[model samples]
Target: MWYEILPSAGIILTFMTIPGFAMYGLNKLVLGNGYRRNMDLRFNRMMYQRDMRLTGDPYKQNGLNAVDG
Candidate 1:
């Protein structure tokens, strides 16, 4: 039983992890440097503004209005 289960588990694990790695690779290829730069900018902004008010809109602090008032 263990012998039979091993192959099945291997196949299941292969199928599960392959697509994730493939998609991650695909995103890296597509987004390239821009994704990392944007993430770094956002991280730095958030780290510097630790005491800023939290709003429902993410772009609020970036000087973009979420709603017209």
Candidate 2:
């Protein structure tokens, strides 16, 4: 009896999880690369600002304070 129930339980779980997994899988397949690139650029810019702050140099190469004397 217990062995018979295991097969039904697997089918029920498949019904529950398969649709959700499919949706996320398709979403990642479609949008994952563009989203990753956008996030990478944002992270790099954040790190650049943080490093400049830690170094006490508020002037980037293009900073207003770095303008010609």
Question: Candidate 2's C-alpha lDDT?
Answer: 0.61
Compose the digit string of candidate 1's lDDT tens values, residues 28-60.
787552222233687777744542344443323
* Backbone Cα, N, C clashes tallied per candidate: 0, 0
lDDT of 2 by residue, 1-69 (tens): 669899999999999999877876775687552222223588777866664565544233344554446
lDDT over C-alpha atoms for residue 59 of model 2? 33
lDDT of 2 at 16: 97
The lDDT, on a scale of 0 to 1, for candidate 1 is 0.57
Q: Ten-residue segment with the worst summed lDDT in candidate 1?
A: 31-40
The Cα error of candidate 1 at residue 51, in Å, is 18
| For every candidate, C-alpha RMSD to the true structure in Å | 11.3, 11.3
Which is the leading candidate under TM-score?
1
Q: Candidate 2: which stretches are off by over 4 Å? A: 33-69
What is the lDDT for 69 in model 2?
Answer: 60
Check candidate 1 and list the clashing pairs. none
